[model samples]
Target: MPELKKQSQVPSQEDFARAKSKSRQFDEIAGRVREAVLDEFRERAPISSVWLFPGQDGDLNGYVFYFATSDVADSLESGLSDEIEKALVRKSKELIGSGCSVIFDSHESVVRKCNGNYFQYLR
Candidate 1:
C-alpha cells in the first residue's frame, strides 16, 4: 500500500486578519467609486437608477444604469448612450485607478433581472 502525506500548508490567524483588512479597504474604495459614478450619471445622463455591485470574482466592480424605456429611446436616437458609457468608464478609472464594466438597460429589464436583490443609487 502506498502512504499519502497529509497537507501541510494552512492559513494562520494573522493571514486571515490581513485578508479581512484588505477586503474592507477594497469595499471602502468601491463605495466611494460607486457614489462618484452615480453622482456623475445623475447629473449628466438620463438614467432612472444605477446599481453598483461586486464583480463575479469579487475583485472588481460592476455598474448597471437603468433608464425608462422612453428615455432609452431618446438617448439612443441622439447617440447619447454611447457617450455616457464612455464617460462612465473614464470616470470609474479616474476614481478607482482601474476600469470596470458598465451596463445600460431599461428599468423594467433590470428590475426583472435583479429580482429586487440590488441597491439602486437613484429611483
Candidate 2:
C-alpha cells in the first residue's frame, strides 16, 4: 500500500489578518521608495521595474531596481550607483532605519532571481 501524503494546514482567520496587515505596511513603504526613486532618476535612468520584499521580521527587507536592458545596467558607473543608493537612503528614513538592502540589476536578472514571486511597482 502507498503511504498517504500529509496535507498542509489552512491558515486561520487571525493568520490571514496578520498577513493582510503586513501587506499593507509593505505597500506603504514601497510607495514611498518608488516615489523617491522616480523623482530622483526619472530623466537619468531607464528603470524597467522595482520590487520590494519583507524580511523575516516582517520589516521592509530590500529594494530591487531593474534596468530595461543589460546595456543600461552596465552603463552606470560604480560611483553613480553608490550615489544613487545614498540618495535613496536619505530620501526615506524607514529604509535607513530598517537597514534595507538595495540592488540595481537588469530586468532579466531580477526575473531570474525572484522566480516570478514579487511585488512590482507600477507607474
The numbered model that scores best in lDDT is: 1
Candidate 2, 26-91: lDDT as tens digits: 678777886787678777666665555556664444454555546345536545556656666665
Q: Candidate 2: where are CA atoms >4 Å away? A: 1-11, 57-63, 66-75, 108-123
Instruction: List clashing residue pairs in candidate 1.
Output: none
Candidate 1 per-residue C-alpha lDDT over 1-123 given as tens digits, one digit per residue, 9 for 90 to 100: 999999758988999999999878877876776666667667766676555545664334554555566777777788777776666567657765666666666776667766644454233
TM-score of every candidate? 0.61, 0.60
Worst 10 residues of 2 by lDDT: 114-123
Best by TM-score: 1
Question: What Cα-based lDDT does every candidate model obtain?
Answer: 0.65, 0.61
Candidate 1: list runs displaced more than 4 Å.
Answer: 1-10, 52-61, 119-123
Residue 101 lDDT in model 2? Answer: 53
